[model samples]
Target: MNRYDHKGVSHYEFLERLHRWLNPRTYLEIGTLKGGTLRLASCPTICIDPEFQLDVSSAANREVTLFYQKTSDRFFQDHSPSALLNGPVDLGFLDGLHEAETLLRDFANLEKHCRSNSVIAIHDCIPMDVGQTTRINNGGLWTGDVWKVVPILKEYRPDISIFVFDAHPTGLVCCTNLDHGNTILDGMYGEIWRTWRSTELSDYGFSRLIEEANIISTSRVETPEEMRRYFWL
Candidate 1:
């Protein structure tokens, strides 16, 4: 449940919602380092990573269909944005090469797969960390240019909602609310609490987002029972 257990919101929170929203039959992961996050998603997965260093015979082995390759090239042909996604992907987690060009390329490929309501979750987007610094090494090829995709997205797809999870050293960017076909920017905070505190969340991932919103509200730990109140059982 804790992606790295650094004591932020549990990463499993969103998958709980996916269980209710789409009940996704297939899941895909771009990076499979030890399969920590991939396994928790609890669905059959197609994963790619060039140097993941995961043991093929370990407990995490059976849950995944591993692909050994550079994720970006395998996902797209001709390196064009239009060739980015392969399609019908219900859940896509981007944790591959962190270069801006690679991320931009990944985003393009993802467009083909994401449904109107599909969730496109990007990891390591929490301000600055190992993921953000790598691109700067390449003369800011990825770090500088990847965020440029944000404005491009807002321009081309004005309907999608963007929410950033408030976990430092590594965070998540959640692109949601494009499914219901509504064109309003009504910020829907997932009230993921069972007792319905005006401040608490009824679900997990969304609750994590809420908790992030109130880092100064309180430093209380959220229990699993409290998490179940807002999400799938």
Candidate 2:
């Protein structure tokens, strides 16, 4: 069985460290089911989820916190991230859907409201095994086909920089050097969906992804300064 051994800090720990170091002015999170990661943000936060099991007290630290209980697509259609946040999102986390097409749409929508320097973190882009990368969640540790987003971005949005960190569990893909005005992804969304929708990890070559991804160890950027310089923050 093909397996990925991620020997680094957990994704949650990494996010906590990132929040403390980056200290973004405004934060946006998709798929905040229980508000574990939502609690990390001290800045004004916008959370979108179809259904949330968040605690009322989890958002007490933020001066402003907006919760939208709807699918990401619906939320984007009804509201604008920048307008709601009162400015471009400084740091956005995409963890809404496990499907590649859905994540791609989420990324495209979020990118339009982010500045060039904004950082967007994509969860579950690295699956531990082929089983974890399936379209349906058979059982435990299901990352789904979200791993497809890494290669999709590399091939389509070459201008953006993607850093895949070996955070515990699945992995964390941090995208930087965003262009809010870039319409490349938006224009080709249909084509991209058609191209990648039916492609499985095995057919795409899991080994190829592992090699091309150049997954980094979180230990290398244990400190905030190192993390900042590594991602060019």
Candidate 3:
């Protein structure tokens, strides 16, 4: 019943395709190291990061694009890029902190600026193993329990639609149907973070979380095509 094939496409390709097809008016990225992913945005954009280690001269050339060398917490504390954007967050990417608590906070902050049509892509959700999901950076590629934020939003914020797909190295989670006015997840940030921090998931628990959240894999053709149509122009 779907129409598009998302096979053989890298995350960069997928993002570029979305930008080309959707032609969003504004974009935001939480982690803008070196500007690799941030460069893919085709609209007026905002990049937030505490530090940078890459040459973003090309990205900086975009007169509409603004770079804030600050943590998400610090950036959202008083600043609002959506006020300057044409629409309530056309698209956003969250790739900072790599911790569930920090990610949850970022998601909550982004939600304040997102509309129902806005889409958010979160990187490094499906870790290869338990060690990769640990709080400490013990592995070569650190995801750092950021995967937990998916289910946290799924269970607590059912108003939104959540999707996960294989993007190599780790994974990607795409969320839409956002409600900027929802206050259910407000004011309980510390409590939610503490609860999820204390909760440990077994392998089975992980599978259950995926199922409960209805996370379909791109390894399956049906999921990708459905997502394509969901975001179709």
Q: What is each predicted model's overall lDDT from 0 to 1?
A: 0.47, 0.90, 0.74
Top-lDDT structure, candidate number? 2
Q: Which regions of candidate 3 fall more than 4 Å away from where they truly are?
A: 1-8, 210-228
Candidate 2 residue lDDT tens string, 1-233:
37887887999998887788888999999999989899889999999999999775765778999999999999999999999988999999999889998999899999999998889999999888888987878989899999899999999999998888999998889998999999988899999989988999999888887888899999888887788775534
Using alpha carbons, what is the TM-score of model 1?
0.56
Model 3 scores worst on lDDT over the 10 consecutive residues at: 1-10
What does candidate 3's lDDT look like per residue over 116-224, in tens digits? 8788888887665555677888759777888788778877988888777655656677888888888777776776777777765554366565455444545453344
lDDT per residue for candidate 1 within 22-128, as digits (tens), equals: 55555666777776656655545566677677654333534535354566667455332212333355676777776544665565566555566566766654333
Best-matching candidate per TM-score: 2
Number of colliding residue pairs in each model: 13, 0, 0
| Regions of candidate 1 where Cα sits further than 4 Å from its true position | 1-7, 10-23, 55-66, 78-87, 128-134, 137-147, 177-233
Backbone clashes in model 3, listed as residue pairs: none
> Is candidate 1 or 2 superior in TM-score?
2
Q: Which pairs in model 2 have colliding backbones?
A: none
